[model samples]
Target: MCTLTCIAISLIIAATIYYLRFVRTKPKLDIPSRDRVVVVSGAAGGFGTAICRDLLSRFNARVIGLDISKEVMEKVYSEELKQYGSERLSFIECNICKLEECEKASERIAQILKEWKTDRVFALVNNAGVSNSPKCTERMGIVEYPEDELLDVFGSNLFGHVRMTRLLYPLMKDGQDGHNGAIINVASVAGLLALGFFGFYTSSKFAMVGFTDSLRREMKSLGKKGLRVTCIEPGFSKTAILNLKPQADTEFGRIGVIREKKSAAILRNAQPPKVIGDAICEQIFSSNNLPHLIIDYWYMRLVYLFLYYTGLDL
Candidate 1:
């Protein structure tokens, strides 16, 4: 019994030390110089605005804000442009879900670069995304949801970003001068751990995570060393996504009502959007190459570790 106890304690200590030394250590990034351009989609949203502000204020990088909602985009521009300067900030009202708009936006960005005498796009932040509609209170089961709604979720959450990446890859690929580029995709912890009532959202994010991993491998195979791909999986955050009506009032509430309350309470202490923005900025500036980043508090990390080691699905 004494030997068994000692062995278990040793294993626990080893695991803990490994997690602390490697998993929690932030990598050092090479900061891009000023005068570079970064394209940020979903720029009007909470997290998007934070990323735009950080890039502009910290790196002085020119930012193009892309959004489907002109009103929201204009609002963000009006509030942010003056502080960041009009020359450094611009807005493109484009729906990323549409191929035509993605192509046109790419063209417009290229023209802007030419006019500015810049040669390469420093980074692309694929942040624009949508969750299931608040009105989707129907049975939380997959078959209960409308097919059209599922398509919309997938379009906004996954395919739109794919389209944008394809359209912008040429400018971001390794250039003659050997300037490397970065692509940051904002996924969610739900992408890694499934939630009961969030079937559609979880599925979309899971697909995103898989797609990002595959893209990274492909880039390496093609010798695109300068280009880096990163996927950020953020835990519950204090964003509009959690601002839905109380779960008890919704139709899907019947499925996981208790878990909903618990989740809401936990999310009450969730990290702010700025935390995620800072993580992205770190990735952009860091010289170290990391494929995935989890931006959440320590407690969440512990939970993830437990589930991962136990082979439990959430």
Candidate 2:
């Protein structure tokens, strides 16, 4: 009897996977270069820079990168972007947390699209964020949790995405075919698994997942069939966040200590930056066919499956 019950459960689960993976959605398609323009935040970092490089190399699409640190942009690219066919790549110093700066960045990209005679941007990648320390309510003890710090992370990871999408909707919203564009928000495994070490960071990313899910539903309701929403949940790719300053740090010099250490350990076990870069490019080019993707290691994927199906609710 138990064996039969287990078999029945297995069939039900397999059917659900089949429906979600194939039946409910249309077959995936790629976005053509003629209609592609990519706007990526945090382009100064290792993963973001790789993503930009892949986009240019693969799609021949015009790319605009926004970062908080001008030095990061200059140092990270260092004329390498110029080699990817001149003037096709550009970078602006803009903090995602600031709305006015985000608007200015959007305006700059809009102008470029206008010059190219492109009606809308093909993709917007929201990858800017800060790692937060794990300080749950129990860990806080008598000390009050800093709501401002929490809000700061949310501003960059969540609200900034909201503002960017709201600003660029017109460009991505399809006029003729009703197929719009794509929005890719870079989340983390920490968000899904609730990393005990980075409680606040995990919370912010979890919120982002919810935000992206709801946004995707809303877009569908609005009949924007062409618009795609993707949440990038990376399980530690080789990146330089180790040297980057933390958003909540009082002294930028010693920021990301725990994260840097943890990330260094993770680097020993993690995949290369190119793997994630290739995945992001795949997402951009093949989003029409497979809009929702969880790009991670096999073990992570198995754990994700268990959590998702078992309703572990991570």
Candidate 3:
């Protein structure tokens, strides 16, 4: 009990410092709404939907939402976005994993920009990726993982976003005269700290975190420029990606499968997905955004701190 208390106190102190450094309020983006053009991938998911609507409501800006499946896109998003006319919102059928597909998307988006008479996209939100939804995909140990399964996970989680960034980040670079351009990638806490029973998914997120950081540093060569790369690490949120119904009739005796269920139970206190969406929008439009924006509770942040200082394997 005493040890736990000490840990809690230390965490509280760390969180206080972190809040002061990264969470303090700042001035809103001082740009005209007419100049804002945001492209969001995986826009049909729970958080994706919230991000699209929030951007439209907050800025009345042009939003392009993309999902791989045409059917899912049509089913999840309504044709009529009230208040803001349908003109402010558009949905695209895109598969970011395919290079050719991403190229085609760029051409289409370029046409839209020409129509909007805007020179560039203000931000690109890379929120599409697979998680522990199927359950079976995560049952393997590191060596037990099949080559094909690993590629599929990385294809959606890492390569897809890389493709999107390569093709679309140029738009952000050439954005309006004074506007800041942002590339926000939604990674998971699983990436920040390795968790058991999530081999492929965790590694993919780890790679994403690394990629975002490297990109940020490389872009810094522009010398005090406004273009930024940010990686958002979120814990359990009320999203179908992680909270999907576990498949039934499976053998519960499997060790990894049981462990996965236990992890899900411990994550019963997931915050709503809106918090994440709002955070992304706020960070984008804020005068400055952190290199890493974490969306979990204080204790989770504490764990991250502990790992950082001690270098202890969790």
Candidate 4:
């Protein structure tokens, strides 16, 4: 009888803690106009560029745009991003997959900060990823999935973010008061949902998702105060990241068929990358304290819940 009573009490205590931790209501935040600094990788790409623009325009944040291609970023500045000007933006041409390059990039950012006299990186968006897809797993067995490609993909998407964060750790001056820095990792829905013939891409995203989760814990333990790590899982956004062929193509080869199918699915559910960029901006300024952000269309929330409850591998 006493043991049963003790068990009931413990259950009640656990329930109360859970409710307080997750279900407590909080007021919405309206952030003040303050200086914010951000770094965005893959910034030459459509989505990455969009995100950079969103942060700059919406939040008035200083942004460092990093990418392997200098010409694309230059064009972006001359054409689409001309009005934003140089006062709020800087570009670094670097291969994120290379640790040396990322280290150098970090040094450059530090120099910029020292010149400008800033304290920390307000947010770092790991928005870079690649997939040599439309090729099935069997076809890619040796060429793409070989040790080198595997290392390259994982290094760029997963470990590169790790290295960047490590290099910037000392400068993350968030959480001293009500402020905290955020790290957002842009993962795909494909990482959570298993898809056939996407072995390499899926594997790399899963590793990234895992790495972000583990890093979140480590950062918390280190008491980064207001430094928060958020993994962003988004459904398909229409971007060149999908590597779509032009609409004029007539013949459907094996690769074309695969791309056609994937494109159709993505197109149906795709939201503008601006939507995601806006959400990320909100996260940086809003004190909502969300664990992760899922940008999806249609019934994706239900799908995520169902998959999670079913014990499916992430």
Cα RMSDs, all models: 3.4, 6.0, 3.5, 7.5
Q: Report the lDDT tens digits of candidate 1 across residue range 256-282.
A: 566676666677888899989978877
Candidates' C-alpha lDDT: 0.77, 0.69, 0.75, 0.69
Candidate 2 runs further than 4 Å off: 1-29, 133-145, 175-179, 224-226, 241-267, 287-291, 307-314
Q: CA lDDT of 30 in candidate 3?
A: 59
For 1-314, candidate 3 gives per-residue lDDT tens digits of 99778767766776775676455744366546554889999898878988887888776778988888767766666643555554677777888867888898988888888887777888899998886323243355656656776777787889989998989876778554676688899888778878765657889999999989988888777755647778898877888766443333334325566676666654787878898898888777765677888786766676666665444554
- Residue-pair clashes per candidate, as listed? 6, 4, 0, 2
Candidate 4 structure quality by residue, lDDT tens digits, 179-226: 677788887766676544443676778777888888888878866474
A best-first ranking of the candidates according to their TM-score comes to 1, 3, 4, 2
Per-residue lDDT tens digits of candidate 2, residues 1-314? 99667656755774565457535754344556543788898888767888887887776778888898877787777666658543677778888788999899889888888776767787888888776322322222112347665677678788888899899887777645444577888887666766543536678888888888888778778764547777777776666533333333323223434445654654576667777777777676664535355556665565555565554543
By TM-score, who's the top model here?
1
Measured on C-alpha atoms, candidate 2 has an lDDT of 0.69
lDDT of 1 at 297: 87
* Top-lDDT structure, candidate number: 1
TM-score of each: 0.88, 0.77, 0.86, 0.78
State the weakest 10-residue window (summed lDDT) of model 4: 133-142
Candidate 2 or 1, higher TM-score: 1
What TM-score, to 2 decimals, does candidate 2 have? 0.77
